[model samples]
Target: MAERIFIDTQSANAMIDNGSAYVIDSTLLQNENSRIKHFENRIRGAKYFSIAEIRDTSAPLSLAWPTFQQFTEAMIKIRLPNDGKAVIVYDQTGFGTAARGWAMLKYFGYPNVFILDGGLPKWVAEGRPTETGEYELNFTDPVDWRQYLVTEHHEMRVLIDTVEQIVNQKNSGDNRFAIWDPRPPNMFQAGSIPTAVNLPASTFFNADKTIKSPEEVRELLQQHGLGGEVITSCMKGINASLGYALQKYSGNDHAHIYTGSFEEWKKLKG
Candidate 1:
């Protein structure tokens, strides 16, 4: 069976209105646009957590995986539904930082998660409503959200040691897994681990930023020798999560993200 990957803006809006869904904007408010913090408006009732917010602050690394303690604490702060509910993630574009939020939620065991196909741009194009102003840190929930705090889900992520072991296995004869690097080719070729391949995440998106069709995605991944279980890695976990989402959308659910990515890998390996 195929794993679900995306939700259209209309269906997503309906769910958000009916209180069956939570929307998260996982834009990575840095690098090329570091000064731009909150956007002017967001999907109605959407809680915004730029990738930087969910990032692990326990150390000096960039966007390292959040610890269980950090994740729970942040969710509590967001007043995320205590009861299990659908979470729809998005970024400025559909395929960028949204995958990070999706990956994190899926890793933590949220079963009904999807990325908003085409993201906020698509939502606005269809005349969906949005809310203005900076996010309120003290927004109160009217439901029993007080009781639905999450338990940490640890099964979908691989650590530095696990990645090393995979490299060793590949150097020998194992081909059961592949590390799918989604960065630019030059960046990948310059310094990537053994058994990793360049499969840039950008190829999975359409011109308007919506994800490509499942058929197209399958072809692209297959062409790159990406099948079965995969570990998606990049400079940070950002692009890695995109690869994970692409695979899941293409019906291959065995993919995992090396959440610390090459940044963490290099640090630990050194």
Candidate 2:
């Protein structure tokens, strides 16, 4: 697996000036237009691409990963860079959906992907330069997308079968993995996969939306005694991805995301 990369506003701005970084706005479409416009304007030359552009909308949970072919198409449509440029994904809400975008790109074999710590909100708070209007990508050939697809890592995702196996292990008292719930305390208290532990994703960020220091994140994970293979889940997979990213950021490469997560788990149980 490639090392997860994260950058502060200063580093991101430097990369942008050199034309080696491609900024992706991963904010949800339903976000207020003014908010979206403000974000776009703040990051000059940033391209807008939502998770919806690459997800399988027909899935019950809606955030399901796309098929290989579908992913290829989306990459072409989004005009992703083909020159091995680094990707910086960001959203209005800290690293929420932006983490998902980073995970997707990494799963697809893109090595230089990074998330903008604190996202657009932090950038604005820092009083960065702002420019209005949209930016366009110069489309690359669809065939180029295939060169970057890494099949082995793609299979590392935690699917329903893996979740079922985890449940079985818990029932038999032979558990080999830990499940991390990134939802709120109330949601975790109401119900979750049996034996799953609550570790709200919010704990990983500061009040200003910036992520906690690596030492702080590592200490928090250690305090929970969470180790070895761990799977992260939430109502959908958005927050879960953030958990997975946080784990990776803390140097736990074995961390994975339960893509179906709580939504699919509930459906399956019913």
Candidate 3:
């Protein structure tokens, strides 16, 4: 396991310069227009990987985790580093998208993955130099990553059936679990899973896009009286992973992600 889940921009820059790390830009790309402009130039030599490419799009909820084989193929296509190199992932929005990448890599048993704290915005704000153009994937022969993958990590994910069971349990006055909704306050207000508490993921990040310290995160969750086994959800699962990551960093190893989230929940209700 990696000693830490995040790296400061200065540390990331030094790692890149020393060729000890491989940077991954996880920002969403649409028609070649990405939220992180000049991304290739901004982080010279950074590879690009779309979160969609590793998702189960055909499912009722598009953000659901990919099948094992699907995940393997995506990893190969991206030519992920396996030579004991540190893999650092970042996105335009602080840890939002990047945390999903971190979670995916961790679930697959990548031992040295980390999120670039504050992401691209913070890097650029620090006046770091960026390059332009797409960085090509360095294809390597495929290795069976399944051997290294954490198969039991799936146990931490909740599907529609389990979610329904949880709601029932809550209704029956069992509070063994707590659902943390990381969607915006308004979106959470519009509709959310029954018994889910709003704890917008944005609250876990500093204004500059860096994640709050573990102590701060612990304090915030404690202030809200949220504890025990926590299940994080959002409109989809992207932001939910951020909440889960925070919980894990704050010493809550039992934190889980409701991958189907409100998207599948609403469909089942309908």
Candidate 4:
């Protein structure tokens, strides 16, 4: 099994205490006011990052995947430590939109990245400390971002071209890869890539939105007939990122995300 990329609240707390971790508050879909309130009551030292900065702004949707240059430059804004400290990414829930940041960082070959298990809700439930203040970034010197440019595992995400190859392989009786759609049931029922399995982000989590154990997730994917490789997709791509992250948490290193999912597919291939 691939080592899990999830960190529990206790472990997260310890990392914070030891000053060996950087926490990214990747929570989106909220404004500065609401975000401020949440930040005022959030885990200490959590840095806020807009999902758009690391996206392909030219793409049809505001949430499109970032180009290599866009991603590297935008990621520099967060100023993640390259000194080997752990980096934890989380959204409103532990396993939601935050997966995009976690996934993108991993795709670029950052080794210490992790998704917080259970997220803020679980942290509060466990009675962890919360701090309030203006978020700050200490950009002592302009980083040589060239060192941090995503250098490997570009295959962590697949484009339309790659999806085409997978489709052809499937048509030729290849069963090693399974397409996964993480959209809601209603949207998924309306239309989806043929042979794609419906394994929405919700299916990989408990009622509380915290992800299930790796063992449970693996079994659930198996129940849905997913094999070794999983290609997760959705209307856009943010929601499906959580599914791809879940696959990694469950030890399927071969899992991938189709960043330009159904919408892009329809535009070019429909």
Mark the regions of model 1 whose C-alpha exceeds 4 Å error after superposition. Answer: 32-39, 138-146
In the range 1-270, model 2's lDDT, one tens digit per residue, is 424557898899889988888888776644466345644465777777767657887677777877766776677777774457899988766676788888788777777889998888788788886577544543555456544444336554888888888878978887578888877899777767767889887887899878887878878986785556888887777778888888888878778888778888888874
lDDT of 1 at 164: 98
Error of 2 at 76 (Å): 0.9
- lDDT by residue (98-166, candidate 3, tens digit) is 878888877766678888999888888889867786555546675676443443357667777887888
Shift in Å, residue 200, candidate 4: 2.2
TM-score of 1: 0.89
Q: What are the lDDT scores of the predictions, listed in order?
A: 0.79, 0.76, 0.77, 0.77
Give me the displacement of residue 16 in model 2, in angstroms. 0.7
105 Cα displacement, candidate 4 (Å): 0.8
Quality of model 2 by C-alpha lDDT: 0.76
TM-score of each: 0.89, 0.87, 0.88, 0.87
The digit string of per-residue lDDT tens for model 4 on 1-270 reads 756777888999999889998888777653555366556777877877667566888888757877777767666766764556778887765566788888777776777888888888888888898787776543446888555656657778888888878888888999788999977799898877666788666877777666678888888888887648889988777767877877877788788899888878877878
Best by lDDT: 1
The superposed Cα distance between candidate 3 and the true structure at residue 1, in angstroms, equals 12
